[model samples]
Target: MTTFKKSFLILMLPLMAFTAAHKFYLSVTHVGYSEKDDALQITTRLFIDDMEKLLDERYGLKAQLGTDVESKSADEYLEKYFRTKLLFEIDGQPAEYQFLGKKYDTDMLICYFEIPKIGMDKIKSIQIQNEILTDLFDEQQNVVHFKIKEKKKSFVLIKSDTKGMLNL
Candidate 1:
């Protein structure tokens, strides 16, 4: 190969790969309130590949998430992981999370949870501590969105700031 050709290839290949690849470690957690049910509905979306990696490294659970080769106990592992890594607090008190279920959207695993007996009016301030993937990924970002009644609040938590407080 010519010198110019090799140089151009080397320069463009990494740029192309960087642009094409979207392997950013991120998770989005949405928390909303239900008046009728008096529940705080929560949904967390995580990259399946990222989750699988953590599961393998930390829990030794080989979950082939978002694939046909996924393990049968994938949900169980997910629940366990979330329970350990995610925490919620209302009015400086610990809140319980009911793991509803999960569904996959493309490469993301969207898990659902609910804080029952909690109404929007009753919440003075909502604090969320999400350390998911932070230990594994130094630059991991956990975006938390709260839709309590008509008020909407958002917090972007990084490895350094794993906990976010939103006053509603």
Candidate 2:
């Protein structure tokens, strides 16, 4: 190769190696009906950094998620956000859930919720609307898994299409 071409290639190689790639925005949620408890249990997993950024951008609160210096009202804000962004319709009727709590695992935050008095036999259909992080991140995707008895269904929710339905 010519000297000029060799020099250009060497200079560009290091820059290319150091350049940051686009980050993938994703969250996973599981919804299961418990026959023993007669309720629907929900768990959502989200990245700590992405959730912190969302809390700050949407609520103007600095939620240092999964850190010692985290905000005291972080849980409250989180529940509020989830209540708005995540929704459910059970058997053609709107269902409400109670935010149980949250726990941090490594770089992810896992939030728990439950809807009580939902008998598995009575549910003909269940619909989920998961818009987590989609307001701030255009490419955000929420993966949802629903289980009832021996039936299981999964969906990948995005900004444009944020709802999924499962019929037994």
Candidate 3:
């Protein structure tokens, strides 16, 4: 009994430490379909603490948001990095990106975006899996909606359609 207890505690120590060091917020990814055009679009939002860090780590890149020699300073690296690093893909092709905007509210950052249209036939299926904020809000199997706007020339995030998906 003592030997088993010791082994269990030792195994849990590293996991507990990792959990303590990381703090995650909730987010959602909306994927919508249109039968008329046979198109699909995906919009994802992450309420992560360090978005810059997450983007850098996940994409394996260090992007500069803009190029303004006169305005570019060491402190402005994050802005530059984000401007260029924000990207998405559809059917394995790089989707066109336009910065819709960003707003800071209460402890969360809401980023809006506009992406080029994608054909739905290429998409296999929609999957919502959480790799970061598994502890805070995990829907496991949820429906995410990506709405199409004909006049807008872009897709809007509709909200989580199903579970493991956090709405907003």
Maximum-lDDT candidate: 2
lDDT of 2 by residue, 83-114 (tens): 99999999889999999999999999999999
Top-TM-score structure, candidate number: 2
Q: Per-residue error at 1 for model 2, in Å?
A: 19
Q: In model 3, which runs have C-alpha deviations exceeding 4 angstroms?
A: 1-22, 32-44, 52-86, 117-168
Please give, for residues 61-156, the per-residue lDDT of candidate 3 as tens digits.
443322233223422443344445333454444556444555556544555544444554455323233233232244322223445342122222
Candidates' TM-scores? 0.86, 0.91, 0.35
lDDT of 1 by residue, 1-168 (tens): 999999999989978976775668899999888888998899999898899999899889898887778889988888998988899999999999899998999988899999998766767898999998998999899999988868888989998888988787
Model 1 scores a C-alpha lDDT of: 0.89
**Candidate scoring better on TM-score of 1 and 3:** 1
Better of 1 and 2 by TM-score: 2
Rank the models by TM-score, top first.
2, 1, 3
The deviation in Å at residue 76 for candidate 1 is: 1.6
